[model samples]
Target chain A: MPIRYPNGQPYSRSPKQGQAKKPLPADTYSGRGMTLEQDIDEANLYYLSQQRAVVHKKPTPVQIVKVDYPKRSAAVIREAYFKQASTTDYNGVYRGAYIDFEAKETKNKTSFPLKNIHPHQVDHMREVSKHGGICFVLIRFFQSAEVFLLDAKHLIDYYDNQDVRKSIKKTEIERLGHQVKTGLHPPIDYLRTLDAVYFNGDAKERT
Target chain B: MPIRYPNGQPYSRSPKQGQAKKPLPADTYSGRGMTLEQDIDEANLYYLSQQRAVVHKKPTPVQIVKVDYPKRSAAVIREAYFKQASTTDYNGVYRGAYIDFEAKETKNKTSFPLKNIHPHQVDHMREVSKHGGICFVLIRFFQSAEVFLLDAKHLIDYYDNQDVRKSIKKTEIERLGHQVKTGLHPPIDYLRTLDAVYFNGDAKERT
Candidate 1:
């Protein structure tokens, strides 16, 4: 008998069990009505409240081209465009280590396209890695509701090798990435995997 | 002889050199035409361009209430209100260490009012300190044109002891704070002081 959680569902040890974990429409990462980014944002709030980490999604920078100060009313931004972010979406201090990452959800069942990540983002991640910051991607496969935390090095390797291949096959991610176990409290408990990927160092590098 | 850069007047050696270094109207932290926050923002941009650090001021979080999408023009945010930041204004990784701080300038010559900082900011800084991240306040005395990087502990002490005292005196700041030397390039070269307060430990702590 598989171990069951408080919700009475068996621990999802594989993709087959993923559905049992997410019964509601909102629980699905790519349910069209929901998003993986929302799940990560909620998890960040939980971590913040517990004082476990200070991670936050940077606000979308906007370039205000025009504004109007209406009489007796708040100033209205009449026109604006989103500016590209210089760094990853989320970053903060975790147990004295700098944590930084971008989160993306793909509905594809077979592979994650490199196009989902901008070239500048890949460059930014590579630059962050050189600065000794722990950088990774929180990639969720919508088809399986399975999430994986893949180190920036792995992403960069494939990004640079894009001339050879346009997309990273699911098999490579399974081999190179750390599966992030989800929970009811903090839907994405990624930091636990951080300890394994970062501190353990060279041992994991072999894989 | 005043020690200056290759360009001119010797770099004044005294911590008092801080005042002389800031000569331009914009250089003055309290100049009616400019501000200390602007200097930090510019310095941050320089740091980014140089890849010296990955620091950035969090965009002022705005609660966008209404927006209009013009047929051919950019989206217009018709209604929005600034949201209170749960954390400080600036935060990011610097040399593998998490650096977080709030920059404030005061025109009052004798004392920097505690009211300039919010209680929530105090609480957030305290929490950040507990997590081993380097936290501080970049306070500028507009009259003297001197900037100091005071550790969060010093600020917290004054914040929690507010019942006993109202504000931090300039004399106390000069005594307890790390005087940051301003430069023509970075304008406020605070990381120099950061090394003293955070890494050297013994050096600026005695201030």
Candidate 2:
């Protein structure tokens, strides 16, 4: 299907349904055709065209060790390694405020494991917030296909007491988060929720 | 040889140097075993670890068509196409101010070609500056092993009259930018220039 925004600009889309199915693994999002990366990318494009806010996922860090150059056309990275990131996945400017966030998905339905998040990520989010930025997490429960926007301050609070509480219950997330229904063009449009919960309220209290 | 910082932190020499050289096409940094991507990555890490600033290369936008996962542990991207980016390469926060920039290198020693930078990148830099963020380009003339910090406003001015002015000459950049000497550890520490230019300037003129 041709995806066109309200402004008449042709929008880009990932491979649909069976076109990308060359699957060998069950849990890999890439095997499922449209990875979360693609969805978020499309979401950013939609946000940009509409002048909503600027958000982007930082690239995965890779440490390269060896390269073999016989012919100078396509350099092949012979040896490389992945490095863990200390910050959240997504960040940008929204309505004159800096926005920072991490995104995650879990197959389990019982609860969202805080273990999936790193302490360094918590520290990074805290730093962003301390510098006066909007920070949060976009969590998706795969089975239910339900997405939630949880504030970073809340996540930081739980993280500080995580040793005692163990994990954040799914029920608690459902209670605190603003539910985001996935859309067609931009599959995950969570910024709309930000407008209501953060902007509509008193700015001083939210900040 | 081992590298050490002034602060006594043991430093790993350029990870790019460790990679085996591969045959890549002419005008491709990848042919030498290191691409533009790796240089920016190293720069970002250096900026972060030193508490200087947070800057990262935006991910290479890819349109993934097919993926093959041979195992549950790894997902192989079988077929993907590159997409043009809408914004500059790097952006982040530093010392209570937002930072945005693009890094480009040219093999040409005489002049930096205008084609190396995209129009949207210039537009994005303009918007970033209007938003009160520090923005610029980190240009490296690889042949001469020299890097220069050209402010975004200067670039935008030239970019606007590109039809008449054509490319930006090296002498012009030399006159406009502060030269950055590459070191063993972080390689390019341009933050010190920023400290002297933006942060340490008279307080009232800032912002």
Candidate 3:
């Protein structure tokens, strides 16, 4: 017996046999089948435990239509549909500034495609920046094992200039985005880089 | 055949026949079956469409231990457990200020029970206020057909002095909390009430 996906293809777990389940890269996505989102989640947990920062990833929204009750167990959701989020994935107060951002991954080596992001998310990031929140996008080039934090403003600018190009060039991203140093406890140390961007030297001034 | 709930009682649908499905009152959970959260959700949608404010309720988090992919359609969440949220139910930017808060309803006429709120929510709201964000709670008295927006600061003061009393007196809440005027387009016009609390006279100055 095989499990079929929505598109009528079999879902497999063979690391060597399938394109979808390709062997995990040791340096990317935690290499143990952990997603980048999972890595950031663990990092958020670390941030909470240490009281270094406060952030949380919004849960995947599901529209539940029907639920079933068993004899002596919890109610089970029998019918539900995935809903598109209207806001960014992660947001919370950091130090004294509001932080909001989205995380995305790309296998493309030359550029980060804009299609990876929805128009709603881009619009949301812009809205966040307009209202004084520290907004950004965490982009991971999985093939190269590189991650960068690109300011939401910069992304919006590129989006508005789509008449010129639909994707952000690798050179532009390298020059504009801040490289996120990987850490042990919390996989991505993006905040260490953010303090330099938002706080500058004043970070030391705060308790 | 009857569907039995976890409590060993049969689920019922009629007001006369069933214990669980008794029709609610107009002011009480909309007896038409609309929960307070649903009203707030409609209000939020109105706010978004009007471009008046950007607020969103975080999704209920679920820890998916297992998933089953059926042959015909989307994957089913076969075995999952509800996860406790770290932050409040709602938080977002409004007129250049970050807004964070929780919504709760009680049947009590004289006092809103402190037990309805968790310690973590109080801590989160306090942190948000310390960082310059606006924080408060929207308390609805279903029996009284009244809703009040109480500042988180006042709530915290009462909470910290729990040795004296476990609940804040109705008089204290009525004296401190702003009465939210109901509106047509956005059911509960809490933001209008917020403008008075947070923006005050400065709201006219902001574009």
Per-candidate Cα lDDT values, in order, are: 0.75, 0.69, 0.74
The superposed Cα distance between candidate 2 and the true structure at residue A73, in angstroms, equals 11
Q: For residues B108-192, what per-residue lDDT tens digits would candidate 1 score against the true structure?
A: 7988888888888898888788777888999988878889888889999999999998889999988888799987769899877
Native-vs-model 3 lDDT?
A: 0.74
Across all candidates, the chain A TM-score values are: 0.81, 0.80, 0.80
Q: Which candidate is the best by DockQ?
A: 2
TM-score, structure 1 vs. true: 0.79
Instruction: Write model 2 residue lDDT over B40-63, tens digit each, in one string.
Output: 688668766766666666654444
Q: Is candidate 2 or candidate 3 better by TM-score?
A: 3
**Per-residue lDDT over A1-207 for candidate 2, one digit per residue giving the tens place of the 0 to 100 score:** 788867665554544432443332233234365666677788987986676766667765445455434342223344444445767878777665667788777776867778778888998887777655677888877777788989888888899997788678889999877787688867987877888877886753266
Cα deviation of B124, candidate 1, in Å: 1.9
Scored against the true structure, residue A136 in model 1 reaches a CA lDDT of 93
CAPRI classification of candidate 1: incorrect
| Candidate 3 or 1, higher TM-score | 1
Selected candidate, larger TM-score, 1 vs 2? 1
Which of candidates 2 and 3 reaches a greater lDDT?
3
